[model samples]
Target: MNGIAVAGLSQNNQSESDIQKLLKGEILLETKPYSAWGGAVTARMYLPLERSQVWQQVTDYSRWVQYFPALSRSEVLHRGDGQSKGAKRLYQVASKAFLMFTAQVEIYLKVFESIHQKTGHQIQFSLERGSFTDFSANLNLQDFKTGTLLTYSVQATPTVLVPSLLIQEAMRLDLPSNLQKMRQVLCGYFR
Candidate 1:
């Protein structure tokens, strides 16, 4: 795909069938198929905002599609509330590919959990399925000289049999760019 592939963005416990859980900080956790073998992915980010602003931005998550390479286009499939639990507007997420190299590869199910006002960010998102055998991340916010340092950490297990060295190389090449973009977007938002 030339543009981004948007995914559905829904609430954590909107459905009576959906289970409710409380976790610290802003994060996403889930498991699904990665080719033949199933996997998991977690992603999180700390915004330079008070509790309200963080909630606003996260609840209105379709805005994030603008920066993500895989999700260039996004829309709210449904709507929800910030107070009482409800499903967030879902999105259709797709990957952007480049000839031989696929620019993005991921399909997710939105899960917005509880928010800790004292902590500073909202907890949401979990993978319903995709490429990695495992995908999970956490976003932490700390005091920065200029603003807030939005630190992100993802621990994943590749679904394929790629060598660790190759995977390391890919991370080295991609992580910096991804981090820079995140900083730019968040900084711009706050500034």
Candidate 2:
């Protein structure tokens, strides 16, 4: 079917509009260059799984590289005591610009994850060290009647010198694909 509609879960109550949007199989993305150094990206998509399931997939740092091709390596530097605390992760990512120039970035990030039994779950991360001078992102998951609605927002600035236009272009090309890949993997999990 084009979309999933399941009952029994209170959090899964989705609006009709949301259900239609998800059935269309289109990823909603908005991006803008905030400064010469970097930009901001907001992406929204639906996944055919519950919020808890989706949260598990996103927080499974060790498996990130397997789903996201751009990631060369993802390692958990430390696991926090609980949701109230936070965790640390290190990632080595490779991106291609202009179809030929490949650039690699190493990121050290501190992540805080929370699961609200009544609402949903959230994963917020900021750069601890690495190639980016500034980087922060929040991944929010909410239950939609059919599955889960994932909203991702990121703001970043590179520490090294890189053209603004190149950074914008790379984000335009990479983010959607990476998100789609994640969706595929999540769907695969249920099967």
Q: Write the per-residue lDDT of candidate 2 for residues 17-52, one digit (tens) a residue.
A: 655766565566667785797877776778878888
C-alpha RMSD for every candidate? 12.1, 5.7
- Residues 1-191 of candidate 1 have per-residue lDDT tens digits of 21111122232222222211111122222323333332222222334444454445545557766455557656665465756366454444546343356644544545554545445443444445565565555554433222333434445555565555455444434444454465456557877
Q: Which segments of model 1 are wrong by more than 4 Å?
A: 1-55, 73-100, 122-124, 142-146, 158-160
Q: How many residue pairs clash in each candidate?
A: 24, 0
How high is the lDDT of residue 108 in model 1?
A: 51
Cα error, candidate 2, residue 127 (Å): 0.5
